[model samples]
Target chain A: MSGQTSAAVAAAAKSVHQDEEELHGLLVPDATDLPLFPLSAVESNFVAYFAPDFTKPSHDHYIYRHPNGLCVVGLAPGHAALRDEGGVKGVDFNVGKSDRSAIKVTGKRKKNAQHFEANTMLCKVSTSVDTYVIRCCVKGSLLEVNEKLVKQPGLLNTAADREGFIAIIMPKPADWLKVKSKFLSREEYSNLRVESL
Target chain B: MVAGSEAEEDLRAFREAVSLVPWHVAKDLISREVCLHCIIRLFGIREPAKGFTSLSPSMFSDIVAELPSTGEGLNGIELGENKDKNDDETNEERHPAPSICSVCFGILQICKVNDAEIPFEKNGVNFLANVIADAVKEEGHEFDSFCVEVSTPPAIPENDLSLLSYINSKYGSESWLQKKPLGNIISLKEALKALVTGPLETKLGVNCSQGTFRIWLTYKEASPLTSCDDKTPVAKRQKTDCNNKNTLVACTTYGLVAENEATEPCVDSGKITMTIPTDGFGNGIAYHESSCLSKSREPCSLSIECYRDAVYFGGRYLKYSRNVSQTCWMIDEERMGVTSVEEIISGCILPFCRGDKSKFHAAGREDIDVRMLGSGRPFLVEIQNARHVPSIMDIKGIEEKINESKSKLVRVKHLKLLGSEAWSLMREGEAEKQKQYAAVVWISRPLEDRDLCTLSSFKDLSIMQKTPIRVLHRRSPLEREKIIHWMKIERISGSSQYFVLHLCTQAGTYIKEFVHGDLGRTNPSIGSILGCRAEILQLDVTDVKMDLF
Candidate 1:
């Protein structure tokens, strides 16, 4: 093979290997499912927000998901890219700054930055069709905006891929305000939205 | 008329045939006086013309004063004046009063006629009465056949010795023989004969037949006899003053008084009265009402008098140290040196002492040699006839006196004053009573521990024992059963063992021989059990118990 074609093939093989490895990880039960909260999350001001009309409180809910339905969500620190109407860089996301790009998660999630880094993966993500994993991050006032979902990126577009892709993806919310209120504080519900696709 | 005269003649013939004897003799023989009088009154009457022909001479005299005056009188009547003067002088000289005889007819006459001597003074009337009563018994005479008579002595002048001399000259002498004339004088002879054969034969310090007699003539003025008139009527006599009289009759004049009062200030006043031993030695005068004497037929005056004599003679110092054996030892002519238990009590100085016989009881007996220690064995010594009875202070003295008097072969201890009932228990029971014993034995060889073990097994075992040969002379040959209560042994010197064997057995068991086995007479004995020949070294009695009052 030529060098460029060999490099592309080698990268694709590495990515497939990584996916296969993550798929194995998703099949096993996680420590969080066994009722073990991480010591770092308990120390920080990591609050789980509930929707305003949620039947049960947020702490009672044992399962959490990413907006892309790619991974189970757990406490992590990260920055989310904020864009104006036209997809443009607005501000750098940090833990304490209050800017348009800075998102404030209310309730117990607001204080998570002191003890935990902004972007960290706490649990594995598994699904019926495809397995995706996500890590949460902390912005100044926003939490879901900074999350990253990793999915099986490229494969031949087969029937199994489409079905697996739909099975693994988190359903998108009809009302972003309600979703935000469910993930963050009610006071910040108007300013932010949470979507899982 | 001729027939009537003929009938009278026949009656005279029949009267003379019936009247024969003198009136006095006939009166004395027959008891019925009226029958004699009726015979005389009917036969002595004569018809008026034939008076002399019909009556007998004695009968005719008796009825002569009763006949009516007859026309034909006798011509031999003496002149009245001359007869009257002679009768008057004779009447003045002789007092012709008739008195009943003092002597009863049933009693054999002991006095002679015209014998002035009294019957009692020569031989005590009451004493002779007893003797005569005994003699009558010996002769087999019935009790009512003889009557007793007490004769009164003729009055004797106090100052006139001449009257006594005159009487002595007239009579023979004042003797028992002279007083009773009915039989031969045999009292002295009989008394002497009895003295040889009687209880006096064993009495010491007394001659069998020794009595003194003396004869003297003296005049004695007698008291006048009291008169009892037939016609005067019978009345109870009042107490009379006899103080002025020279002589007073005891029973009659004194009229039954107490002896002390009767003989007050007499010679017997100062002496104590001796009482008789009725229930044996230490027993006092058994009262008439006493149950012991209740069965006696007659009142026991002899017992009473004997008690009086014993009390009177014993005086103040009574010795009660000796055992009260009922009988005394007798040897040949004397009662030996041993005095009777009664005599010992009687001779005791104390007037009122009492005691029972001495009994020897031992817890275990010794062979006459071993002495008892530990308060000299618990024994009871019953003191008898204790005059001057020891007070608490005198008990020690009395005990010392007894110990001093006896030989060391026998020792008396635990001296006590016991009642009469205690004596009865000792005398009445069997001698073979249970006793405990301790004996020291000398073995032919020393005993081993095995032998001692064998001896210990003999405890609580019963053994049969034959009489010991040494005491066979006094005891019957018989087998006796004795129980061994317990035993303990101690080793003494070589070949000698001191064995204290306690046995509850009949009282008279020979403890010494029992230990040694009496040459095998006592089977299963200490010697036999140990399988060794043993001999008694010493035996001692440690305790004696008798249930007594």
Candidate 2:
């Protein structure tokens, strides 16, 4: 909401000190801890990638920066998708807005079955520039996930309970958030409907 | 001054008294005393002196003149008169006797007795003295000097007591005589008689007479008197004398007796006879000549002589085995255990009839686990020592006998009666010969194709190896060169593989280790070439070529 430069915003996000104004900018209230589950632990095809420049379609994608070098990057699937035709068709059409909205509503119904929970509002956002660069500095513990997630694809179906989500190859962090928020909001809305009293 | 003059005149009278004796007599007495003094100085005798001052001058001169002078012409009349009275009587009967010796008395006699029958020619005196000296020395006496003196018949040879007493007393001090006490007086008489008779007449030679026979019976063989086939006749010449007709016969008889006494029975042909059996089996009886049935006490060196004889059995006649070992296993039952070699030869009746024994010589031995497969190991067996003799025409029979004796475990082919040189060559040629073998190796893991290819390349490669650890305890540690003549993989089974390896090596090369390679103790081993642990399961000797020079 404030007209802050990208550098200022990055600096403010990185600052360890929690000021009232910065806290208000974060979406989830009264939560400082982030919950995380490994991407591999999820059964559903919910995996995402953050591509800084969609037109160039290069694999060099950065998720976050920390004092200790680059902390997250896109894992190149490379020719893995090409070798399996079923993998492409299953996730290709779902990226459209209408299709995204419909999946969000379905995701909301499935939210109760997911396991992980998170408070942080730092999501990877896409930009209008030819190269989309998303910058968010979060606490080191906010991104940690149990290592078993890498080995089992079923574990990734759980909700990520963490302060941040990182998608290095995807553009439009806000749009991604809207889709995720809609899923969560609808799940909450549906639970209210079920409990009339 | 008057008393001094009287003392000087007394001194002059005493000097005159000492000088009245003849100068030579005084000189002789002085020289005798000087000689005694010299002896005393050399040997350090510590006897005290006695006074001779009271003797009259003539008496003193006579006593002094009695001392012997070294000169030939200076004869002392008193010394001549002192000779024992028996000497004067003998001086008339025979040619005048030499003055009697004071030490030996007249016991030592020198008489030349000629006997024509025996073929001995020697001077009597020198021989007698040598015999006496040898006898005395053998008795271990310490006498510094000795001389022989003879008395003629008029003198009672035994009665001259002074010299006899001296000899008797000296004999008492001799160590050998003291240990075994001889009848001193009787020994003196007998010794004198022996000196007169020589060794042939007396069983005890001059040694018994001179009291010098220290060691009796110096040899194991019988006495020469028992050995002689002819007996000498004795004749009584007089009441006091017996005569031997031939002194040469006497001497020769004694010499033969001495020879019999000195020669060892085992080595002496006259005492023992050895007859080695000519049967194919080296077994025979040794007998003493005296009794045909009695076994000889002497151990004899064996010399085996072989003869060929034909054998007939089972409707087929066969030549007896040739060059078999001297005796059958039954004969060697007392010596070594039954070797597989013997069992193989004796298994069949044909072989048993063809040869009594199997003589085996090998370039080297293999572990019992190994089988000699190719061309059989180069071996030679001398069969003629056994009792079964094969004729020259029975070569086919001999061949059949050897083949029939063969067992599944062992077989002898190409059997031949090799020359004596062949045995020598088998023994001596081991250092230069080479052998080939095939071994089955069990590896710890399966061999990759690359490893197999690498192993095959090892053919014809030479390797230097220290003796394998498995045989280290029995063998001396040594480095040997073994050339891989050829190697091929016969088959592969899981982790086990079979290899046929040809090694051109010295006869005794450890073939099994060459295949499995003993923990890299052998260089360029099969295990190392294949880069896996390997061990031998079974081994067979394929070929052995040994050349006889």
| lDDT agreement with native, every candidate | 0.30, 0.34
Model 1 spans > 4 angstroms off: A1-197, B1-304, B308-367, B370-396, B403-411, B427-432, B493-505
**TM-score of candidate 1 versus the correct structure, residues matched by position:** 0.29
Error of 2 at B520 (Å): 2.7
Docking class of 2: incorrect
List the RMSD of every prediction in angstroms. 56.8, 41.8
Cα RMSD of predicted structure 1: 56.8
Work out the iRMS of candidate 1: 62.4
Chain B TM-score, all predictions listed: 0.36, 0.38
Work out the TM-score per prediction: 0.29, 0.30
Q: Which candidate has the top score in lDDT?
A: 2
Model 2: per-residue Cα lDDT over A1-197, one tens digit each? 35568768878876635543432232121212211221121111123223322223332222322222212322122212212332222111122122211222112122212121222222222212221222222112222222222232121122121111232112233433543322222234334334331
Model 2 per-residue lDDT at B143: 24
Q: What does DockQ come to for candidate 2? A: 0.00
All DockQ scores: 0.00, 0.00
lDDT of 1 by residue, B1-549 (tens): 124454345334423422232233223212221122222222222222221222222222232222224322222222122122223234333422111111111011212122232231121222323343343334332111111111222221110111111122222232421343211112211222221222222222233232211011111112223231222101111212221143223212211122222322222211111211111222112111122111212110110000000111110111122322223445356553334333432223132233222333322333323443322333223332222333544444454554565432233444554344443455443253445444555554655776666666655677877654454323444568876665656444323333334344456666765676643457676666776555554444443444422
